[model samples]
Target: MKIITLTFFSALAISVCSLIGPTSRAATGIGDECNKGGDVKFAIREYDNKLVSVCRADGVGDCLYTKAFGKTFVDNRLHLNSDRLHDYVIKDLSGSYGDNDVTHFMLFAQCRDGNFVKVGDDFFTNLRPDAMDRTTGWLKLRVTRDCYNDSISDTQERSYTIVFDPKKRRYGPPDSNPKLTHYCSDAELALPVGSANSSR
Candidate 1:
């Protein structure tokens, strides 16, 4: 009886340790310790083995950090360019003028000195990874103009191709072909679906 009881206790201890180990580690995930103000919330994930934290200010729409991530800017759209030795973040920005908001996009590349350099900045409607050439450092973006203002002129949507120039260490100028205009509604241009409503 003594031998059986000791064996049972040993197995129970091993089981308990196994359950607690992973839970404790997961509870301490990267960026989980960062101090987010009362009005802000952050979601943390691992991209290319680095902690990527998406922080929202005022718990509302299109905060500056969110726009610096991408059009979708959510966890699903976050990507890492591992092909290049250094990591880079490509995102968009917006500003308010009276009742109108203007949005623009940019690219920031991490330098060897552990600082980021803004490599590209321009007006763009939407951006997404170009799967066909992402391994080669290419991206697909929707081009538009005056889409945010009250005026409806230059709201046409066009497709543009952008490539990363490793030698110059910056994204090259966009290449676009003249095409028929496609107008996008405000809802279509708004933040990614369910982003503003997400609890996280």
Candidate 2:
């Protein structure tokens, strides 16, 4: 009887180990890490007499912050939306198109809470000068597509405007000055695209 009991207990332990082994050994993918808020870090600083902040990885990795407005934190820079305030804007290179020798551009904005959030999509071609209209609180950006193409480089230019809504403490939908002529590649776009709506 005792041998039978011991055998039963050993079988239970083996079954439990079998159940836990695969789960423990399974690799953690990006989606899994992102859902858990991963390993991003955020820091706040003072820029233009306003509190500014950035959320990035400890090492070079994907950014996880999003959202804007109010006293909420999201990506890089944070600020409140008010006419008396200047929105923090960041222009940076996303990455290169592998060996294609093409670089991409990305735009980021600061929310009232001192976190920076990305604006619009990646621009593939030549980007005209970016400007912020202080009077109307509108940000204007223009970009040309396929400027590097060898055959007559059919460069199509498009402009976009982003407006801030102080009441809602957020920016309105992005509007294009000239509608897109060609479809931009969705591949290799930035991560954490939209607002996470997180207070953190």
Candidate 3:
């Protein structure tokens, strides 16, 4: 049983690392990576690994080293603490977009351009939280002028925050650590969907 679990985690780690790479850099915007300007932050992490900053293309972007709370993004449902990574925080997460309540959540990205031509897709779509029950949470509405620009001009500087009920799973508990994002999240996090949102 121990060997099996270890092998499974190892495999998962290798796979995630491949997808995100040793490091993640936003493209000119979000094409291959992202193009971040001043005041914004970014990060990426593999399963069971700590969140490490790749580098900063812009700003007081200090470097960081820590693990974020959750992994996996899918259908407006994010499973928090599923990893039992119970020592991270999410307040002041870029643009004041985080709170201690940001344990595990989802963001729905849509291109309001009336055409799905450039941007459209569900951000997180993998894994089930072994730490607890799985449920849907958060709903977001957005549009992109240039789906690859780090700096976005919000023709509609508005976004929606939704909480989806598991109905079957009950909302996952909110386990937090106000020290998560502060220490190193502004640069990188295991599952930050900001890049996912900004791309589209």
- TM-scores for every candidate against the unseen true structure: 0.36, 0.34, 0.18
lDDT of 3 by residue, 1-200 (tens): 99999999999999998887633421111222112221232232223332322222233355332334332312222213222111111211222222212222222111122111111211111212332223322212231111121333321111111222333121221121222213123322332333423212
lDDT of 2: 0.36
Give the residue spans of candidate 3 off by over 4 A: 1-61, 65-200
Put down candidate 1 lDDT per residue, 17-125, tens digits, no spaces.
9998765543332123223222123332234523243433234565345333543222123222332324334333334333323344545433333333444555455
**Model 2's TM-score against the true structure:** 0.34
TM-score winner between 2 and 3, please give it: 2
Ranking of models by TM-score:
1, 2, 3
On a 0 to 100 scale, what is the lDDT of residue 192 in model 1?
A: 32
Q: What is candidate 3's TM-score against the reference?
A: 0.18
What are the runs in model 1 whose C-alpha is more than 4 Å off? 1-80, 83-102, 132-154, 176-200
- Candidate 2 lDDT over residue span 62-142, tens digit each: 433222322222222322222222333333333455423323333344433433343333444444434654543444443
Model 3 poorest ten-residue lDDT run: 114-123
Best model per TM-score: 1
Q: Given candidate 1, what's the lDDT at residue 96?
A: 39
Question: How large an RMSD does model 1 have?
Answer: 16.0
